[model samples]
Each structure stands twice: as structure tokens, then as C-alpha cells.
Target: MRVVGNYRNPGPQDEYSQGQGGYPPVSQPAPVRTEVNAGRLWAGGVAAAVVAALIGLVGVLVARAVFQLSPKSSSAFGDDATVQLCVVAALAALMATGIAHLLLVSTPSPLSYFGWIVGLLTVAAVVVPFLGSGSLVVRLSEAVIHLVIGIAIGGLVSNAAGSASRLTLGENR
Candidate 1:
């Protein structure tokens, strides 16, 4: 007979090492899966839209009442320029949400990509008014409004994407 110790070497056929009614076998951990919750993301998108519209309204009001500035009469939106601005701001928020969702689904480090894209777009919006044939004050006011709307869209949607994603371990059984 051989002396037995509390700890024994586990051979290839050992039942405990094989997880046979004993200690489970050591194995690599399951990979994690990141799942996006669409409902939450869309809800955040809607909130962003409302915020953008409100920003547009307030920006226009401030420019008109406080600074006595207004969009050019020959603008594409014509006489209803304020109303058009609000609508466009809301639409831009929604579009940003769409881009965020798309990136979350298809890319790695999606928020980084989304930030860069939205930032560039915002800069473009801020610059376009200056390029047009408008007075300095009016163009500056328009650029400011666009900047605010872009910032609101980018920030709100990025927060939404973060809150809507969850990580789960892949099935291991």
C-alpha cells in the first residue's frame, strides 16, 4: 500500500479534474457580448430632439430680442425662418441618434467615432453661415445657434448610447 496525502496529483483520467461529481474543470472564461437596448436608445433620442428644438427656439428668441439679430430674409426657409430652424434642429438630433446607433452596432469603440463625426459636423454647421452672404452679426448669431444645437445632439445621444448598452458573458454551458 502507498502512503496517501491530503492533496493528490490529478492524472489525465482523474474524476475530479474531469468534473465528474467533483471539482469542475478549469477552462477559459466565456467571451462577453455587448447588447444594445433599442428602446432606451430611442427614448433618449426623442429627449434629445425635444431639447434641440427648445435650444433652437431659445437661441432664436435671444438673438432677436436681446441682440436684435435675425436670419437673413432670403434664407431658404423664407418668412418662417424661426420655425424652420427649430424643425431642422430637432431633425439633426434624430439623425445623430441614428448615427450613434449604427456605430454602436457595427464598430469598435463606437462612442469615439460618434464624437469625432458629430464634432466635425457641428464645426461645419458653425462655419457654413459665415460662408454665406449674410451680415456679420446675423451670421455670427446663426453660427452660435448651430453650435448649441450640435453640442446638445452630440452630448445627449452619446449619453443615451452609454446607458443603453450592457455586457453579458457568452453562453458557456
Candidate 2:
């Protein structure tokens, strides 16, 4: 059988021989087969935007609640403080989430649905208790809310900042 690319004891005049110059004709060097679809770009970008928006919403609620409960004695959250804190927290969360998506995930997949679920559940953790917590329920409910919010916030931040480093360093881990 004649084998393609076989170079066993090639003749003197054959390519790769001492007489003939090395390297293939420069006309082409194997055209690269690339799959660049606009759909993929749009899907990834929108998914990223949605995650950012959700992070914003969840962060606003959680931050507002936490700040409200801070030891500072204020009858009502000053307009400037409440608005500024929520905005900062939301923007931080959104940017963190987008950065996370870019770093952590290779090839955008359905895995980000997991983020959506976690973000939503984190919001629920806070909202449910505030609406009705008359007994020891307030403490338990707030604890759950804080834990979930912390997890969501921390995960987003870490995923964004440390994804590449973690992947390269933690290969065996």
C-alpha cells in the first residue's frame, strides 16, 4: 500500500532530497478551518449581559438589606447612601459576573444556567424572610439569606479573577 506522507528512503530528486530545496511551495500552508458564527457571538454576549443584569438585581437587594441592618443608627437609609451603595454593589456584581464568564468557562455552554439559578435562589433567600418573619424565623431567614448572598457574591468575584490562574495551577487538584 502506498502511504501518504511516507518518506522512507526517498529518491535523490524527490522532495526533501539534498538536491531539491526544502519546504513546500509557498502558495499555501494548509488553510485553517475555522468556525466563526455570529450566532455564537450574539449568544455568548447576551448570556453574559443577562448574567450581569441578574447579578445587579440580586446584589442590589442583598446589599440594601445588609446595609440597612448595619450597626449605624439611622431611622431610614439616607437617599444618597442607599442609592450609592446599591449602585456600586450592582455594578461590581455585574462586572464580576461578566469577568467570571470570560475567564472560567472555555466555550460558552449551558452551564451558565447554573449561575442564573443560584442568583435567583439567593434573591429568594432574602425576599422570603423579610415578607414574613415574626419569630425565631427572622434570625434563621437572615442567616440563610446572608450565606446564600455571600456565596453568590464570592463565587462571582473569584470565578472572574482567578479562573485562569486556578485552572493552570490547580490542574492536578
Candidate 3:
């Protein structure tokens, strides 16, 4: 018998000539399953926090030295600007990482949703300072700081989610 296709000669049990077959049926490979690595996610979170804190520190320095603006808090307890900004940035980074982890575990498309969440939060943070009774320079500086922190958190965490995951194939679905 002549084989009409590129497939190798069929075996005795193969039914290539059953009906409209040119070659034996090919079995499809199994789908791959991906699992996230929690340790890498945590490392990314820490790195993001450190970067955000540095950004906040730089913002504070620029506000004070370059713009000649002093940031004042509306809270009851007077707080050091540098310390408060850095702490808040770090906390925000950690919070973003937690949210990212939850989304990655629960949702199929984590990055898209995470981006929306971080972007909206960043907008709110920027707008919040404008509503307060701060000088233009202070408001602008705070907004910049918030923007930088948001970028760091969103970019780093999403990248981490990709890097920390492992894909396993050939497993039964």
C-alpha cells in the first residue's frame, strides 16, 4: 500500500485507510499548568518597597532643596516628612504586592486588573493632596511622589508574578 502523506508507514493496528485518512491520527499534547512561587513574589515586594522609599526620599529632598517648599502634615501629631513619606511608600508597595498575589491566585488575567487598581489608587492619592490646604509646590511634590510609588509597585509586582511562576506540562487535567 502507498502512503499518500508525509507521515511514516502506518502499523498493523493503524487505521489510516479507514475512510478519508491520509495519515494516522495524531494525539495532542496535554496542556501545561502554571503555579506561582510565593518566595519570589515576596522578594519582588521587598524590592519594590525599597525602590519606592528611595523615590519618596528623593522627592522630599527635591521639594525642600530645589522647590524651597516645606511639606506640612494635617495630622494631629507632627511627623517628619522624610520618615512619613518613606514609610507610606513602603507600606503601599507591600499592599500592592498582596493584592497582586491574590489576583494571580484567583484570576486568569491578573496584570490587567492589578494595573487598573494601582492606577486608580494613584489618581486618588494625587487628587487627595490637592483637596488639602497645602501650597502648590507641596501638592505637586506629593503627587509626583505618589505617582512614582504607584509605578514601582505595579511594574515590579507584575514582573515578579511572571518570573515566580512555573509551568508544568504532561500532567493529567
Listed in order, each prediction's TM-score against the native is: 0.76, 0.30, 0.73
Q: What digit string (tens of lDDT, one per residue) describes model 1 on residues 20-72?
A: 64544357679776789999999999999999998988887777777655456
Strongest candidate by TM-score: 1
> Where is model 1 more than 4 Å wrong at Cα?
1-29, 70-79, 171-173
The best-first sequence of candidates by lDDT reads 1, 3, 2
What ranges in model 2 sit over 4 Å off?
1-9, 12-29, 67-173
Quote the positional error of residue 106 for candidate 3 in Å: 1.0
Residue range 10-127, candidate 2, lDDT tens digits: 4556655565545443333343222333344334444444444455445445544765443355434434444553454455455545544553444333236546644665566456
Greater-lDDT candidate between 1 and 2: 1
**lDDT scores of the candidates, listed in order:** 0.85, 0.46, 0.79
Model 2, global lDDT = 0.46
Q: In model 3, which runs have C-alpha deviations exceeding 4 angstroms?
A: 1-33, 70-79, 167-173
Pairs of residues clashing in candidate 1: none
